[model samples]
Every structure is written in C-alpha cells, then in structure tokens.
Target: MYILLILAAITAINLGKAFGTEKSITGKSEYALAVDVRVSVPSSAFSCMKKYGYKTVFVRGYDPTGDGKFDSNAVDNIHNANKAGLGTEVFMTPQPRSDKKGSQQLVELYEGLKNGDIKVKTIWVQVTSPVNWFPDTKINIDFLNDILSAAAHYEVKIGLYTNGYDWSQITNNAAADKIMLW
Candidate 1:
C-alpha cells in the first residue's frame, strides 16, 4: 500500500506539471483572425488573413470534395495555409456527434493537416444556429471537453465562435484561450 501511494503521488505530481506547462495565449506570437470559408473562396480568404498580417487564421469547416464530410481537401487547405506562412485553425460546426465522435473527427482533421504538412494552431467550435439551438445533438459539454482535451494533446488551441452564448454550456474554459467571437 505504501508503494502504491508513492507511485500515485509521483503520477499526480507529473500530471500537475504537465497541465501547468500547457500553452496560453498571452504573447505576440499568438494572433486572432477571421475565416468565413463557408461563403468565401478558401485561397482568397486565407490570403486576406495574410494580407492583414494576422499570425493566426480561422477557417470554416471544409468538405471540399462535396462528400458531405471533411476529406483530403481539408488537408490541402492546411498545406496551402502553411505555404502562405500563416498558422491555420478551424471553426468546427458540429453536425451532431458525441464527445468520442467529436474527438475522432478532430483526429481525422489532424491527420489530414499533419499529413499535408499544414501546421494547425487551433480549432474553434462554431455553433451558429439559434433555431435548433444545438445544430448537432452530438455537440454538448462533454463533446466540448473532449475536443479541447484533444486539441491540447495535439498542441493545437481550442476555441469557439458565436454571436451570443452558443457555447455557454461547456465548462472547461478552454474556449477563453481558443476562441475569437464574430
């Protein structure tokens, strides 16, 4: 029992140190941007961010192939952003999912971005439907927590964007560090 207690203490200390070292957005290297890709040309939209000299560029979720889901083209966008020398991020519009599903979606997104050599700096949830309230039933406090946790694991900032209190449900407070309201 004493050995187990010592191990637990060491683990706790390590975990605390790790969380303490998590990144914060309090420096000039960090920047804010706007990406309304849902209604704008991606290349042109990203270029606008560069022209404006924003270190970070937010992107609306892309289903470039019209497959009804994000695909390799999403990766291509990340590569394009990297080539432009700007950090990329995504504004996720959940289409109904659980925390596990949301995490998997991010994994897929990260895979595409990493494989395409695109460096993603953050991902912000975009819950913009006031009619349905929750556009995707999968989007919830648990889902937000899962996404933010995943973003931290990947070293990508997590954020959310909405006109009002769309994301008022999530309690992790990561969106404070990760979001840019529009």
Candidate 2:
C-alpha cells in the first residue's frame, strides 16, 4: 500500500512538471524583463535579446523633429520585435515648441500605428526633458491633457515617463493620478 502511494505522488509531480506548473509551485515569478530603445535595431539584436531573457521591448514611435512625424523605423522595429517572439510597446517624445499641437501629434502617431497594422495597449509619453515644456505649469498641464484626450479619442491608453523632479517642474505633478507612470 505504501509503495502504491509513493508511485501515485511521483506521477502527480511528473504530471505537474509536464504541464508547466512547476514554476508556480517553486514560487518563481512569471513577470518578464523589458527594455526601451530609441533607435532602430536589427532583428538579430532582438533575437539576441530574447535569448538573453528579455521578453519585451519598447521602441520609440515618434520623431520630435520639424512639425513632428512618426519615427521612420518604429513600425519595422515593432514588427521585428514581434517576429522575434518579444512583446512590443511604443513611446513618443513630444515637442512642445513644434508647429503641431499635442492632439495633432497624437493623431499622427495613432494614424501611423494604424497604417502599419501595429497594435499597442499604451503609448508612453516621455516628459523628462525640461526644455521641452513651458515654464508655466498651466500650459504644461493643458498640453498633457490634450494628449490624454487624444488617447481616449482613439480608445488607446496613455502612460507618463518622467522622474519626480521632472514631473514637478513640468506640470507640478498634475494629473499624476490619472495615468500610469513608467
């Protein structure tokens, strides 16, 4: 009877291992490591990243140049990352002094993503550069709100990428509670 019980326990353990439940039993985290890149990289790089256990990559999607346009390599990088079996996300650096409004910039980004047939859950807005924002907190707040509204208009989410000091300087930490921080 004791031999039969031992055999049954061993079988259960093997079954769990086969079903990939050993990690849960071992208390191993299922979360993935992520990296953000501003420039375009080749597929081989992404493959290397995956082999090294990077599960997600955030690629820059917007170019804050004259009039502000989508980054030329954003779509291709996203596709490459996906093909390499890594989860992909996009971030945009907005130019406050550009001719385009915040909403217009977001429109360009959204349309670009749509045209590329790329889907992203959220577009993280980088607000780290102090020179990119106005000195008046109210204007900065309005600019962020415009982007937020644009995100909502397209049924997409928005996240902020800023440190505490930059956040305080930019919008006085306004709307901090409304969006996810990265």
Candidate 3:
C-alpha cells in the first residue's frame, strides 16, 4: 500500500508538470487543476467542476468532419465556464485528409470564434491519431506549417497535443521543440 501511494504521487507530479501546475518550494501545487470537454455542458456543471478545484477548461472549437465547421456549442460552453469562474481556452483537431488546407481550417475556426465574441488566447492543435494524418511525412509537415502560418496571421498561440510515437508517425517530430506541447 505504501508503494502504491508512492507511485500515485509520482504520477500526480508528472501530470502536474505536463499541465504547468508546478509545485511550489513548499511542496504545494502553485496552480489548480484543469479539465477539457468536447460537448456543451451546463453552467451548473462548470460550477461543480470549480467547486472540485478545477481552475480552467479547454473547449473543442472545431469539427473537422462532415460540414467541417466550428462547434456549435463552443461559444456557449466558454461563456458558461467563464461565468462559473474558470479560465477557458480552445482546441482544434485538424483534418489532414480533407480537401481543405490547414490554413483554411484554422481560418474557419478563428473567424467563427471571433464572430461569437470569443477571444482565444491559445489554440491547441491535436496532432495525434496517425490515421488522421497524411501518410507522407512531408505532406504532414506542410499541413502543420499551413496551420502555423494562419495562426501567426491571427496572432494566437498554438500548442501541440501529441506523444512522441504519434508525432513521429505524423510529422517526424517536425517543429517539436518550437511549439508548446500539451
């Protein structure tokens, strides 16, 4: 039981580091926990999450398939989260196989968020799931570059959501050192 407790503590520390919830010199977390959701949640849900110690929420901002449009609930979700006293951010899962270019995808999301009066500080781009990426590494790199270029035009920060293996398979770890990782 003591060993299990030790392992749990180690896991928690690693997760804290990954989420930027660094531990202070006094051994207490300097930041509160965060949560991510892809669906529209009630305002009461966000209040409960805050009550449980969550400080932030990341909402899905785009839908890549079918209509390839912004998520209908993203604005409402962000407002609800903010109303419940949680910091809100947005994330997009790019569709590399679609006919649309990366820049076009990002523009659609950015404009939608802007029209809804949702100010996004950082847009986390999910680059996992090899099946969602192009088979050619160069194509994947170009696609990611397009997204980066468009993000620059909008002046929003971009974060990558990927593991080493998935990243290697998708873009051969291109620009891994530059962009923030989630």
Q: Which candidate is the best by TM-score?
A: 3
TM-score of candidate 2 to 2 decimals: 0.80
User: Which portions of model 3 miss their true places by more than 4 Å?
Assistant: 1-31
lDDT string, candidate 3, 37-135, tens digits: 877788998898789887778788888776367888788889999999998879897788888889999998998899999877789998889987778
Q: How do these models rank on TM-score, best leading?
A: 3, 2, 1
**RMSD in Å for all candidates:** 13.9, 13.9, 7.3
Supply candidate 2's per-residue lDDT for 137. 87
Where does candidate 2 clash, by residue pair?
A: none
Q: What is the lDDT of candidate 3?
A: 0.79
Tens-place lDDT digits, model 1, residues 1-182: 01001001111122212345658623333224433344333565456657976454445453422222454345655556656777656756654333235566666677666676666787666655544334443445555566667777898876555544444433322235424443
* Residue 172 in candidate 2, Cα distance off native in Å: 1.6
TM-score of 3: 0.82
Give the lDDT of residue 177 in candidate 1: 45
